[model samples]
Target: MSSTQKPVSSEDALGQKYDRCLADLLVKSGVGFGAGVVASVILFRRKTWPIALSTGFGAGAAYADCDRSFNPARIPGTRILPKAEAPASK
Candidate 1:
């Protein structure tokens, strides 16, 4: 018998990972920058550090998410159960 699915190459896997990381970085960093801008304008008297700080936080969060995606075992509250086996015939 033959399997129907195409085998995935290492390059394809790497490409997929890179795509995920890039998307996460863009989205997270954008949100963080927006938040920083708001905080800086409202609370910090238009300081530049808040924007930088929040952007860094967002980038860091993206890094954590990408790391978790690459290493699922690092995720919190995960459980791995054993498979069941059939009984032997007499």
Candidate 2:
């Protein structure tokens, strides 16, 4: 049995690269938020309200960073995928 390989077009390759970059940014941001939340809790327990607040701000900043990084403004001229394309199995 012979299997034919389908070549990826430049557009497809670019799309894949963009997707990977966006995904990595999101994952890292999520990790940052999680770590921030944990640290905030720890600081709160230690009676350090200022540190806890700062950690909470860090989480918010991480989320904003993710949004800004993935935003169309940051990646001009690239086609934005529809919401349906978000699922990995799709």
Candidate 3:
């Protein structure tokens, strides 16, 4: 190992994923809310359903991304490495 290289454990990797998921959730939901508000005001005549629908859509997308992050199999066209060739997370 080099002096500048730091070993990362599975726990650390999990934590990083969680942090990224949280950030994505917040950003996606916020953008959805903004879009919903704009649509509600201009197109829907201030209806509340558009706001909720848009926000839910954004949150759903974020959730899907978080799912893929934790479970690589959820991603399409990806094959699992053979156990012998896979790196040990520990």
Candidate 4:
């Protein structure tokens, strides 16, 4: 241990992670919701809640599973997005 360094407790680490995840969830969902509204308006030419909600959910899911096309686990909670897969060699 360094003289000026302090050990981080498990609880603190967990709290920090929780805060980050919550923030990510809120930001991603908000952006998705906004995009959905725009898309719905463009497609239907009217303000519709149902279509907007559906598209927002889809967009949020896409954001959570950014690495892959889709991930089922994303529906549960905000998750740290998975790492990108390495490109396959010929």
On TM-score, the candidate that comes out on top is 3
| Ten-residue stretch with the least lDDT total in model 3 | 1-10
Taking the tens digit of each residue's C-alpha lDDT, what string does model 3 give over 1-90?
Answer: 657868999999999999999999999999999999999999999999999999999999999999999999989998898889999887
lDDT of 1 by residue, 1-90 (tens): 996999899999989998999999999999999999999999999999999999999999999999988888789996554455545559
Clashing pairs in 2: none
Sorted on TM-score, best first, the list reads 3, 1, 4, 2
lDDT of 2 by residue, 49-86 (tens): 54545555655665565566557565557676689886
lDDT of each: 0.92, 0.64, 0.95, 0.64
Clashes of each: 0, 0, 0, 0
Candidate 4: which stretches are off by over 4 Å?
1-3, 47-90
* Model 1 residue 23 lDDT score: 96
Candidate achieving the largest lDDT: 3
The C-alpha TM-scores of every prediction are 0.74, 0.48, 0.85, 0.52
How much lDDT does candidate 4 score? 0.64
**Clash total of candidate 2:** 0
